[model samples]
Target: MKSFAFVLSILAVMGLAFWAYGENYKTQRALSEVESLQGQIGQLRETRAVLRAEWAYLNRPDRLADLVGMNFASLGLVPLAAVQFGRVEQISYPRPDALPSELQLGPITGAVTVSAPANAPVPAEDMLIP
Candidate 1:
């Protein structure tokens, strides 16, 4: 009976040892995967930095101007002048179509604050001339 109990205990210990060995390998694999991902992230970050530097180099105004000059006949590019600008009031905003007659505005219940008196004189700074 004692020998049987001892054999059972030994088997239990062996089973546990095998389970722990499998777990250790799984942990090692997970660590390797994490390291590989970190290496890829570092490579991507380096590539992004190099690309940003290249973009800045290519977007230099002088280089762009030279390129534009070379393609001017085909591009028909023109310089901007102050006369090209327009006043905000000159913009023709598109109005949304009216809802079907069946739909109407809901009741307004929120508190509305009037910032300035209706009779107050207009401020020069608030006016837009152009």
Candidate 2:
């Protein structure tokens, strides 16, 4: 009976060792994947920085102006002047309309209530702004 118990304990230890070894390998693989992903992220960030620099260089106003001037005959390009800009007051704005009020949860009222001004326009199923 003692011999049987010893054999059982040995088998248990072996099983534990096998499980631990498998888990260790899995952990190592996951760590390696994480490292690889981190490296890719770093490379992507570097690439993004390089692309941003290139974009900035390519979009320089002087460079763009030169290109436009070279192609002006075909492009019908016009030079911008201060007079081309408009004042904010020139913009036509939409009239103020009643927007849906926020819902309040309290012990006094369990139901939801939408409050709007009496002069508010009838709520449309679909609001279109054009």
Candidate 3:
């Protein structure tokens, strides 16, 4: 009976240790996966930054104009020379007096009448505002 009890105790302890070791292995694996994912995220961010810079370079005004000229030559959007551009002061504008001044009034209402008392002191609030 003593030998059997001792054997059972040893087996229980070993079983507990094995279970703890499995849990520790799983935890370590999860931490490693998290580190790998962090590395991948950083790489993706760097790639996105490089792509944004390349996109800006591709969208430059001169490159866009060249692409349009190649793709849409029939649009007739010719580039102007310096001599073709006109000064703003050389543009003509219609004078305001050229507009007709026709009177068109709506129905008028009677004005309200109020008489002030003689020798009344000016209100203190009105003096303060002015």
Better of 1 and 3 by TM-score: 1
Clashing pairs for predicted structure model 3, backbone only: none
Report the lDDT tens digits of candidate 3 across residue range 26-115: 999999999999999999999999999999999998998897788675776656579898999989876655645543323345432344
Worst 10 residues of 1 by lDDT: 105-114
For the record, the alpha-carbon RMSD of candidate 1 to the native fold, in angstroms, is 12.4
Index of the highest-lDDT prediction: 1
Ranking, TM-score, top scorer first? 2, 1, 3
Q: Which residue window of length 10 is worst by lDDT in model 3?
A: 104-113
Q: Model 1 Cα displacement at 77 (Å)?
A: 0.8
State every prediction's TM-score relative to the real structure: 0.63, 0.66, 0.47
Give the Å shift of residue 16 in candidate 3: 1.2
Each candidate's clash count: 0, 0, 0
Q: Give lDDT per model, in order.
A: 0.82, 0.80, 0.78
* TM accuracy, model 1: 0.63
Candidate 3: C-alpha lDDT:
0.78
Clashes of 1: 0
